[model samples]
Target: MEHRVSLITVGARDVETLAAFYEALGWTRVDSPDGVIAFDLLGQSLGIYPLAALADEIGVPESDLGHGAMALSHNVREKADVAPLLDRAQAAGGRLLKPAQDVFWGGHHGYFADPEGHIWEVAWNPFSALGPRGEFQWNGVG
Candidate 1:
């Protein structure tokens, strides 16, 4: 199996709200009427679909799901950008899980949960290298 993730579809209670949140983050929604909205993220795609409908389409019972204890992270260019990015997340109806602060590993980071309880981390590491898409490449420095 390949070790690459090409798509990530998040089940949202309200597709419009979820779409709006991401749109506010500068993601443009591709036009689709299949009840699934997609956003292009660099080379990958992030999709939002209605929860129950998505489960039905996948042939899974919605009640059989477990808690979504996973988190998606976004890395920024500088440590000073952490707090402001976090503010944007909060302003977009996400709840603050952790205020931006220094981590034990010598980086600044924080967490926030989207309206649907999907956790997202915003972090800044001085020793990390970032690609043009703003993703971080950990070089084992800080």
Candidate 2:
């Protein structure tokens, strides 16, 4: 089996709605077939699909979608960029969870929830440098 992830599918209650939120964040969504939308990231793709359809395809109930236990993160290039990113998220229908602040690890971070309650963390870690394509080579979120 491969050791890296090539895609990430987010089960959204409303596929189009959630997709728009990401689009508002300046993410260019790639064309996908019916019932799914995709956004190409630095080294992977972010796919958005209807929650019910995804659950049915997996042969599980919608409750199987892990809620609070997991979070998606986007690491920025500069510490000053954190607040604006969080603001952009909030302006795009995401609920502000934790306002951007200095973390104990000397980094700055914030949290927000999409319209469907999917948690996303926006952080700036000086320790983990982002390449030109926004790829983070670090092992941890910090």
Candidate 3:
């Protein structure tokens, strides 16, 4: 397998509502099949699907499909862009989990929870400068 993610799918209680929340965040939807909503990113796509259906497909009970201990991160090119994006997420019906501030690692960052309760980190890492098209690498864009 290659070291790349083709898609990141999140199960939402209400797929349409969750999809709209992403749309509110300035993500335009691509043409996808009926059961899913997808937004294409630089090299991958974010997918939203029905929570119950996802649980069934995974052979798990819906109750066991709660939010996991993981977060999705969005890296920005400028530290100044951190707070505003958090605010934007809040205004779009998400919850602000943390206010942007200087990190011990010499970066600025914050967190927010989308409508489906998926946590997301918005960070600007000076050590990992993004590529020309906003692709992220752990130690700066090669």
Please give the RMSD to the true structure for each candidate, in Å: 2.3, 2.3, 1.0
RMSD of 1: 2.3
Best first by TM-score, ranked = 3, 2, 1
- For model 1, residues 1-142, the per-residue Cα lDDT tens digits are 8756788999987889999998887779995779889998766889898999988988989865544778988888888999998899899888999999999988899999888888999988767868766655677332
Clash pairs, model 2 backbone: none
| TM-scores for all predictions | 0.90, 0.92, 0.96
The top-ranked prediction according to lDDT is: 3
Worst 10 residues of 3 by lDDT: 29-38
Model 3 lDDT tens row, 32-82 = 666988999989999998999899999999999989999999999999999
Task: Evaluate residue 128 in candidate 2 and report its C-alpha lDDT on the 0 to 100 scale.
Answer: 87
Global lDDT for candidate 1? 0.85
Candidates in descending lDDT order:
3, 2, 1
Clashing pairs in 1: none
Candidate No. with top TM-score: 3
Cα lDDT computed for each candidate against the true fold:
0.85, 0.89, 0.93
Tens digit of lDDT per residue, candidate 2, span 33-126?
Answer: 7777999887789999888998899999998865657889999999999999999999999999999999999899999998889899999998
Clashes of 3: 0
